[model samples]
Target: MFKEQVLGLMDQAELQIEGKRKEIDRIVDRNQWKVIRAFQKHKVSDYHFAGSTGYGYNDRGREVLDLVYADIFGAETALVRPHFVSGTHTIGTALFGVLRPGDELLMITGRPYDTLHKVIGKPGDGLGSLQDFGIRYGEVALLDDGSPDYESIARCISSSTRVIGIQRSRGYSWRPSFTVAQIAEMVRFVKEIKPDVIVFVDNCYGEFTELTEPTEAGVDLMAGSLIKNPGGGLAATGGYIVGKAKYVELASYRLTAPGIGGEVGAMLGTTRSIYQGLFLAPHLVGQAVKGSVFAASVFERLGFVTHPRWDDPRTDLIQAIRFSGPEHLIAFVQGIQQAAAVDSHVVPEPWDMPGYEHPVIMAAGTFIQGGSLELSADAPIREPYIAYMQGGLTYSHCKMGVLTAIQNMIDRGLLHLEDN
Candidate 1:
């Protein structure tokens, strides 16, 4: 049960965020229509939802799905498949697909998500990562304000620099997510320096948040997991890569084999959920964004720091709340788990999760394993503790989750309402 003060705080937060919620709704309206138009143009029907068999050769359903995704994202082509395991895997495929052993992959955004460190690999490690294959990696830290450091980026450019990577979301960081306008500027900036350099965006948690995606802003390639924003909470599993036909083609080769490419791979009965999920994505993403706004306002009012405060422009679903210590951080995350529709009885603890350097605590009790689109929270057990909360199939669910987390913290004396 929620304390009276907490309930009052949530009411105040909701009232304070009315205008912001309206703007999110408007964006959702635009995106929803865009999705409908794309689906209608491609004539999506029940037939397209049917499953496919071995090799999935000549799978019209799968082919049309790619067309639909390409149209929606404003890309030359798209490869939507259940084959891709996670967002990290999808992004790695796109990178490895296009980069040669001698080429350099530069990240303009400080560091990528934690899972990507291994994928970047250490030179001569022989673990078959990008560096293991002789593909060099470079990174330019964002400016103090979390904006791209153009001067640094320009200085980093070289003859071997083949790709400029931009992470649209602030993965595990306190920085603000980059907007489409910013992404467009980054694209122009990089291309101006090297006319032939490819601009790639890691678009996880950013899909459907804006009216236009990075691909439309001149990105050569972009990748995201289906269980995130674009999945609409229905897609059981998958990932998508969209961009220039050539780049997508190359990525497909890496996704499958050199010759097989996107031509094969059975649907395994995931076609319907994938299609329906895209159709519902715009509305669902709007709900999650609204929830993020509410969370920011509530936490800020409680005297804690929050990234991209309630009034800031949102480009992704992640809402970061800074806690004073590990106890407060862990309690907040476990509180979120207590609000889960599924597995609410299970308590979460910090563990050394694979692909991460620190012990990470996560509260992901959703229908789909690791589905961030369903109200979930996670944080690494380290200093300047911050919990990255994201996703909510509905705004009400997200609101309840936040309140539950607060109540949990209050019960443990980690948070006191009067401190505000």
Candidate 2:
């Protein structure tokens, strides 16, 4: 069973979203053309990923990327750049952005994303980890079996707190997800305890998970990527951080000039792709969510433990599955890819990379493991645990990916139809 305990509150949650949607509709109905014209002005950014802005110049592409990102995330200020390669990098930049010589960052989530352990702790690549950067750090914890312990967060709050980072969704954790309302509750809790502490959200796959963003939930800074939800499976690259204007100005400098200003320079052609993706995102996010639902049902029927069901959702559109071993993990990725691609153009394989505390393997057909259009499925390369994580652009695509994997099992006479 895909474990979700908040079902009792489903009715109330639905009502809240419906009201927000209606409000948004009313605003749209009143300014329909104005919205249309604003979107039309958004131009897609172009990149080759081969060189400096891919333009044969020492040009600054990140500045332009930010302008488009500000429009994308509904923030007072934003910055976008290819240099912010992964979701973690974007977060590291944001945290380092606001921390000063004497302040500290209190991480509300107990164990952060695995790879980030070093990035924030001492022994990491740079001179000082999150702690060494003049920002002392501490962690609020999770209860057993994975749930936020808000009281722990409150007890940890102190006068030296410069920033409080809240990871709103379940990433690689065994933890259950939180709704925007719950996220809002946490934000409010933090604010009541310390009004000036910056509330940052690692808003990875949770962009439209509920109906509103963390900005509406009172987050000071939020980060996500173009390769995920808001990118609409269209943007070729980038990450965005949006929030208060002054912090934004500081973060922008951290991203580029270290302590200078936000408008450092510009990317040659980033304006168009970011614009197009943001314009198309609302519809596309809906499509991806539908695929996620389908995936949850299909796998749940296979007797595998699924994190979410067709109707059960945690964060955004990710569909997570658990397999037994490394062999199964590799086999599963290969099976899904063999079934997903056009003539099976891309093959799935297992691999490991640096910076990750664990040995990670992924289905490579994906542009990026967590962000690709192909029906790519992946599980970590670990013993006794291989959690398959998959997402897609359309229902048909997701359906094919899972079905093909099932078909491969069937074709090998691995199982009989009568068994079902």
For all predictions, the C-alpha RMSD in Å is 0.7, 7.1
**Model 2 agreement with the true structure over 100-155: per-residue lDDT tens digits:** 86787887867677767776776334756776665677888888856668878888
Model 1: per-residue Cα lDDT over 139-183, one tens digit each = 999999999999999999999999899999999987999999999
Point out the worst 10-residue segment of candidate 2 by lDDT. Answer: 1-10
lDDT of 1 at 419: 78
TM-score of each: 0.99, 0.80
lDDT scores in order: 0.95, 0.63
- TM-score top scorer: 1
Runs off by more than 4 Å, candidate 2: 1-72, 123-128, 340-347, 367-370, 410-420
